[model samples]
Target chain A: MSYRTIDRGAAATPEPVARKIRGLSDRAIAWIFVAPTIFLLLAINIFPLIWTIRLSFTNYKANRINREPEWIGLRNYERILTDSDIWLNMQATAHFLIWTIFFQVLIGFALAWLINKKFKGNDLWTTIIVLPMMLSPAVVGNFWKFLYQPQIGLFNYIIAFFTGKEPSSFEMLGQVNLAPWSIVIVDTWMWTPFVMLICLAGLRSIPDYIYEAAEVDRASKLRQFFTITVPMVLPFLMLAVLFRGIENFKMFDLVVQLTGGGPGSTTELTSINLKREAFEKWRTGYASAYAIILFVTVFGLASIYVKALNKVKER
Target chain B: MAYSKLATASAIAIAATGVAHSAQAEDLTLCWAAWDPANALVELSKEFEAQSGHTMNFEFVPWPNFADRMLNELNSGGQLCDLLIGDSQWIGGGAENGHYVKLNDFFDNEGISMDDFAPATVYAYSTWPKGTPNYYALPAMGDANGWFYRKDWFAREDIQAAYKEATGEDLREPQSQKELLQIAQFFQGREIDGKTVYGAAIFTERGSEGITMGVTSALYPWGFKYENEPGSYDMEGAVNSPEAVEALEFYKTFYETATPPGYTNSYMGESLDAFKSGQVAMAMNWFAFFPGLYADPATGGDKIDFFVNPPQNIAASTLGGQGISVVSYSDKQDAALEYIKWFAQPDVQAKWWALGGYSAHNSVLQDPGFVDSQPFAGDFLEAMDGVQDFWQEPAYAELLLAMQKRVHDFVVADQGTAQEALDKLIEDWNEVFEDEGKL
Candidate 1:
């Protein structure tokens, strides 16, 4: 049959079908297409989040399937809040987060500033500088472990070379005093490149005319840098800080690979402690509560940080 | 008529295929820690495969991640592992959580007697309530902490004379913990073969159970006990007795004075490396690794010798090894059980030993020439006789982690006194038991 004949015959038939087809709006059709994605998000992300929050209120163990979870009201949260070890973990995490970000921002901005100056083999130097961040954090953690070894590690030997101390005189990851700094050093080494790249972008985005205008106005090199360069780059620097802050707050794999959170809980971040509770100890409810606390802390801090960044940008 | 004939032929063909499939070999996945014995088990499992008409698939995770991976699989009800040779401490958790198939009825029906296994292995690996008849697993590998030393270094005439002159005693195998410490101290920074060598590399690993495993050898010999009574969570005095404090102090002293530089987190692998590299004169490690150590061309061949962990007030060694269990979540329990049955035979166990896997079977361990079979065989038997284990409660991980942190802080970090560390450990363990409603 001809296509026209088939279409005419179909049109002549079923008034109910034609009305049904015409009744659906463009917005309704769009909802039909987007429904699956929304359902998936609810299933995988939202559902688990709600379930975890619910579980935080109970005495539940994921491993003990034989026992039904008992609702213990705010017991888990109360215990966590009162727990000294959790506070110690928080202290360790804070030490790590503060020191790592400080070093990364300082060294990263310096490197970016230097590289932004047109220099010989600048592209090659940039690639080399970015290499550590490009590698797997697990791989970097493992190799850095070897490098931190006191007996044969190149790191100790290099330090010894300059300081006139014995190569095996100090233990990096072994001593309580050195372990936290050791993790900080490694994190700075690996992630500083990321901050450098962001700063480099920020540096490059400043229009040449701004610097030229400053030069014509007889502004000193340092004054121009502070007034024009840094102020303009503040938003991007804040963005870098925000990203690193969130990432380091939940840091697990690298620290785990490097030290497994310890010569003693000295380097145990909150994430590492939570993992020990949730998976190793099988304390599901306690871990969930701990996770929620961490979530709230991160969320509250980031919100404040973003608002501050927005204010700075408005200036 | 033709359609009917075709249908009949197809039905017969389908039945024939089903029968063929049933007769074909089944594939069984056995999960274990990736260690020397695991490799040995892989070689030994071939015999089972050939005899039982089943193909063996192995999932071997490294020691650090093994418990995490396997427990996750069990908790998630994943059927990834049909048979799991899990750590001894997992018996309580597995049994209570129904992760492992209860093997009592199966053992009775299959005529597989638990009595055939070594008593300590059965106690550590199979039972949950210490001495109960409840069976969840079959003891597969037997291990206990033992010492390996450089026999050649001790045999040197100059070193022997110097050691005797300095200590006023003959240089020999340590008969007591005091002597062990002296030997370790004597060898520390001692020049051997024109190279400076350090002392014994004991387990100081901070992460998992390394320090606890190492320190307990000293603890048990120095009169440390977990409780005043079995099944009681009462750890107040027993875990922190005066002798236990002394033991902890001694362990810390040894770690500081004897071990090589940066030996902060050394476990079996690190100890082996230190020994093989000639960086240390002696080391403490599990019996399971002894065979591999003895076979190493660089460090073996009259240069190395094995000894039991020395006595103090009492002689004891830390128990190490695992039991094999069928995962309850697995669909192929029958096949897995058949594999176990084949593995349980005396000959197979003997072959397992010959392939370097520690066979916990009494028949294998009790062989007339078993002690004479390998260089470390006698030491293994002696150590196994005095083996002590950590708590086997369902909350063992919590207890272990607390001990790890406490002991590590005191021993490695030098953060607190031994008494304080043990007291803190007691508090932590009591808290865990309270949470479990056992206190």
Candidate 2:
């Protein structure tokens, strides 16, 4: 009778057991497929992340490797959090983010909409407009620096032509107020096309039948655009925002080449400050802590943004 | 047939031994910044290799990432470089961190005393924080900061005559900050060399070392000190003194009126470019660039001239240069030390001067033969005499960054009054000192 009860229970639960056995094999296969990828991810990303976190708790100067690292828990974090300069750098980064996002989205959406309309040489115009995105940021920053030159630059020359007086003799990168905005302008020029490309894909993916049906319903072009075009492209727009946000958040090379966080700390982003702390100052522990803080901040923002993007997509 | 096979095997063994000997031949690797001085050092190294029977491998890195690259190499415990040429400011950290092999015994054995070098050059960049801290590096490039001008323009009889007529005083070399500013004002917006030239050019960029070096050269002589108090490592009152504020105000005036309007972003490279292009009548520069400016025809090689940094209440110039040191991690420490000994020989130093190396040996620099050989030797030695070495501390890089930021804010941002900027710098510098437990 006990044996019979056991058999009955086994039969009833066989679905989950069989499913679990099948799931185990499936998991094995899945792991087998992803083993190389996992190895790569660990090698390229997770290992470094763990090492950086470990270094954040120890005093590790790059120049002094042989010396035993001392555990200085929470000191680096304390320094960064309490430091006014770090906070100022954070403000600078925030300023860059707000201005860059506003300009990139507004300008990008408009360009995408205009290009979606079948105009003459639409393909050629679109290609030319998108070219800046393909160019390296360093290359673009360098050329724009040349353009802002007061004496021999084309930008000044054109300004001089319009005004009867010689162009306003302001040094764009030299002025503290202007330097941050200069970076914003250049970033916008280079990346608006990227946003536009995504929006364009979204626009093209919207079925033409929707527009046809709206026209049959006697909806005005403005009404149709608001009801269909915007709604359809919103998800793609969020995706573009997510990408550009992450990228611009970690900007280093271009700023280093262009203004070098200069004209004062006006253009010194958080990443640049962190670099100065770590490599230049050789305060490894402090820099690592700064990195962790930045990672957490960016990760949190990105997570929230990604969820929003998913919601938009679902709708 | 067995005897024949044995003979063949012996012959093959002998050939393999020969190959092994070849593989063991002496090879030395050297690394440095890929700047003009580094180029000169490379040229000198070829001569050394030819004479010493050692094959040399050269590694030249760009200036921007140079420190990080050298640090990585040193910390890796890899035999990347046998002989490393590095900035003098790195000496303290290098010594404290055991990145460089101590050279006191080596110097003594070689009979190459530090006293032979310009006293100012030897101490500023080559010495560690503690006076007796192992003496890790040999003073190699005893470079200093100084002023460069166009001799042709300065000696212009018509301009001098006009200035003399107006002021009833002979227009001559600048001897003080007051005179330098006056000279700048005299030449502001003047047409020269077929273009409108500015009076002066100096670096003012943020986060760069150039601005701090240039600005502090003026400020220090005017009673500004980066240390908090004499004989104290505390860095509070020194940076934001009344004298420093006055000096900065004077600097601002020159930048606003006499300098090229775009002076705020200028660095060594840009300042040199401006001078070479004849956009500026004078510039403050690293003395290392003197040879290159003299060699390059684009800058009127024969016409360019220089002066020791002028005094305000006292004479001063920013100390800048490189030191030659053996890698502490080297497997061939003895061989590296041997190289430094040979490098310090009087005859070798003379050759170094001939090949454009800034000889730290006073005997070579002050040699009548050397002076006669190079027309600019006198000025170079004069500038060397005036140089004050960088502030030596284990946390020097951080100290410099703090100063650079504040100096940038003062000159470029105009974010606060000069006093306010200097006060902030003092506070920041003190914070660093406090963190390091020196204050």
Candidate 3:
């Protein structure tokens, strides 16, 4: 077990094998473990991003392989920037993002606050409320479509019962004014639970001693809630908003199934429009440019939002 | 002993050849939209499988996603499909991009005459350069926009009396576009059998090609043409002409006044459901669904009747349905060709019609008993004769999407004048053409 004894035995060993063992440095060993993953990331993610950026500069029609891809530098970008339809799509996406985030935060916070109170079957009630978030969005979109049907949809029937309007009189996914809201309603229903769960975690994380200290000072319940609970939960709420804002910006499948970006493009989000351009129209080059613009917008906004979230966390 | 050994070797060689021939059998996959006709095709293809010694695998995507799925498959040169039943508008793209096998040699080798198939279908579904003989597909299914109405309700004595009193004509199938409007207006919100029903259900879907398909039924009869010259993309006057504007306006008026409340984005499925549920007096749909509608015990049988889409100034029906094409990327080309050859026979075409598919073969269509084969058969013949299709350019998706947005905006969203909508559509299409260097 002594070091000298071990060194004497090592001195008697063959040099080639010992040299081979010492040849690989710790840095070299680290690289051997990491190279495959780095190569894989480059192949799957970074390479595609670079390739997409290159394709964005060419006039490439995916379906027309017979034709050569012409170099049309800045033309695709120029056209997309000037396109009125694209601007309208941006407006639609912004509208959806703001409203969905607004509703999800407000309602989700309210639900989480209610569930945080000690009550009978609170765990069961919380699980039931989060079920919408658990279901597949595609399934929800399809069923929500039925629910918005003017003739037989229960959603319309419920609205009619409350408002004294005919069930078939209003078209939720059919009218110009109402179609946008229809998508909003469905998105809110499916995702509010996600926001609720995050808000609940924030609520539960607040220590009981903070409230106990406030109670000793004879502060009102409403004042204590505003002074302590609201501030404590603000960062988590901001984090939830940031997640929702990014997700709703790229909304496609649900809106596609629900309104299909219609009652005349009132709900055509950026993602749906991009898909139409790339796949349906086969304008791969133009779509790539459009996609890059979208990526930049989302990345820029998300970075700013995260900074704000971190600042709140520090506070 | 040498002669006997030679005989045994010859017998073994013949048996080996026979085994190799049997082993050549393939499992060919045919891709198409999931629809009533697709189900019927599954039944008809059994005969082809039995005859050709090839098993068939079907990939049927829903109509909404069929184009996206199949086009991606074709564009990626995927071998998922040996044969594709592509939409009529896809002929130009498929042919130009070499997604479809050039069938001129195959047709000649198989002795399959293009003349035997319906000329309109051959033009719409086979040829890439419009009317040229450059064949890429075989006309498999023929469809056109036609009207189905509640004949039982129209024949009610009291309702007939009321219609006569109001319009001084029998409440029958409409003969003119104006009369169709009048009839629709008469039936709008009308009570029948203690239930209130609306006038009609037409295409208003906006996500894909529904609005364009539905509106063109009205547009064609009003003399809406895509261009002044056949190949030229000069759509300034043709698409937004005064007549086309009038036709579009009439369609919007009909939609606004006659259609059931909350029928905003209805397509084939929605229209069928509306009719089957007895919510509408008239429904506009493709001829492919007539057999199924006629067989329905509740709303069909003796209760319903169909008519050719009524004319405005010219007689025309909007063409639908697809042609079967061998995928150029298929590994099983021989087996795919065999399926087409077997499917093109006169007897097989007749059986196709009998199995609820619209057979485009003239041998089946011109049969003496063909018109009497089904209730809507005669109207189908008339409609097919006058059928017109939308643009079949390589950039057809762009053109079609432009029309969908423009038409849906005007007709469904009530946003702009018909003239403005068509003018905007002309602008959108011209941009696409300019991008493709066609302008």
**Best model per TM-score:** 3
TM-score of each: 0.94, 0.89, 0.95
Steric collisions counted per model: 0, 0, 0
* Total backbone clashes of candidate 2, pairs 3 or more residues apart or in separate chains: 0
Q: Write the per-residue lDDT of candidate 3 for residues A1-315, one digit (tens) a residue.
A: 599999997997799978876899989878989999999999999999999999999999888899999999999999999988899999999989999999999999999999999999999999999999888888999999899888889999999999999998899998888888889889999999899999999999999999999999999999999999899999989989988998888889899888888888888899999999998888999999999999998999899989988988898
| Whole-model Cα lDDT of every candidate shown, in order | 0.92, 0.80, 0.92
Q: Which candidate comes out best when scored by DockQ?
A: 3
What lDDT score goes with residue A103 in model 2? 95
Write model 1 residue lDDT over B289-393, tens digit each, in one string.
988999899999799999999999998999999899999999899999988888889999999999998999998889999999999988888888989999888
Look at candidate 2 and tell me the lDDT of residue B146.
81
Per-residue lDDT of model 2, residues A1-315, tens digit only: 999998987788869776776667777878889999999999999999999999898777765565677888888888889988789899999999988988999999999999999989999999999999898878987898888777777776786788755754766777777889888988999999999999999999999999999999999999999999999999999988888899989998778777889877889999899888887877887788899999999999999888888888889
Q: Rounded to one decimal, what is candidate 1's iRMSD?
A: 1.1
Q: Flag clash pairs in model 3.
A: none
Q: In angstroms, give how far residue A313 of model 3 lies from its true place.
A: 1.5
Which residue pairs in model 1 clash with each other?
Answer: none
Q: Is candidate 1 or candidate 2 better by TM-score?
A: 1
What's the CA RMSD of model 3 in angstroms? Answer: 3.2
